[model samples]
Target: MTIRPIVRYPDPRLALPAQPVTVFDGALRELASDLLETMHAAPGIGITAPHIGISLRVVVLDLDPVDGARTYVNPEIIWASPEMILHQEGSVSMPGVNDDIRRHARVRIGYRDIDGNAQTEESGGLRAVCHQHEIDQLNGVFWIQRLSRLKRERLVKRFEKLSRG
Candidate 1:
């Protein structure tokens, strides 16, 4: 698997919604593998196909080495808890910047596996936040959009400064 180049912040493609993966073939498996390599190279916990400009609703997450990596195809949040928690969030596309974001403390996600088998998983804590975050990305919502205007602006400025250096 190759570590594909990530589309950086402010790229118009990053703002656009990703298309759903239809054919579960070798190409889809290759894309998921590439996404895993790219996410690992980015040193991030999670990443989506959009992060590499593929525009497919594919997500690869490796929250912990012990649990191993997971590939989610066309993932969507099936349920979310009313209780919320503030957790630090960031994106592989926008490196070096993160902020506290409010997200559901627990979530149930419905997605397909690499082999196109339908599956569902319930999670809490960081995994729950990751599910919400990556699904939002597939829906064309950047993580910073969840922040207040002032906070988003400030974080963008910092990211810009970091990009420059």
Candidate 2:
């Protein structure tokens, strides 16, 4: 397993829709391992395949305060409650900034596990928010996208300025 570099915001790849993983081959397994390593190295709770330049519907998350991790392949949000919560969210791709984003407090997700078994998990609070955030990355969406147009523009400018220096 290797730590892969994260794709930054405003990159074209971040806006490209990821393809579904059809073959559970060794390469796919390696990619998952690499993603986990990368996420852990980033000290982040979640990561998506596209974040490492792999445009596939794969994500790794370690929301457990304990020592466990969850890998999701082709994950889909099956259900979400109307009750919402706002949390200050940050991304490894967009360093040095965080924004409060509104998201469902609870969600039911369906996906295949690492062993190729189908499973569903009902998550809430931080888990729910993390899952939704990672899933959004799989679909070419980012937390900043939830911000207002003016705010997004300001962030873009900020990112641009930071990149220059």
Q: Which one wins on lDDT?
A: 1
**Every model's TM-score:** 0.98, 0.93
For candidate 2, lDDT tens digit of each residue in 1-165? Answer: 998899888688988789988888788889999998998988788889998888999989887767588789999999999999998887878776777889999999999876677899999999999989889988888879988899888877887787787
Candidate 2: lDDT over CA atoms?
0.87
Clashing pairs in 1: none
The sequence of per-residue lDDT tens digits that candidate 1 reaches over residues 1-165 is: 999999999998988999999999999999989999988889899999999999899999898879899999999999999999999999999999999999999999999999999999999999999999999999999999999999999999999999999
- TM-score, model 2 to reference: 0.93
Q: Which runs of model 1 end up more than 4 angstroms from their true locations? A: none
Task: Find the 10 residues in a row with the least total lDDT in model 1.
Answer: 58-67
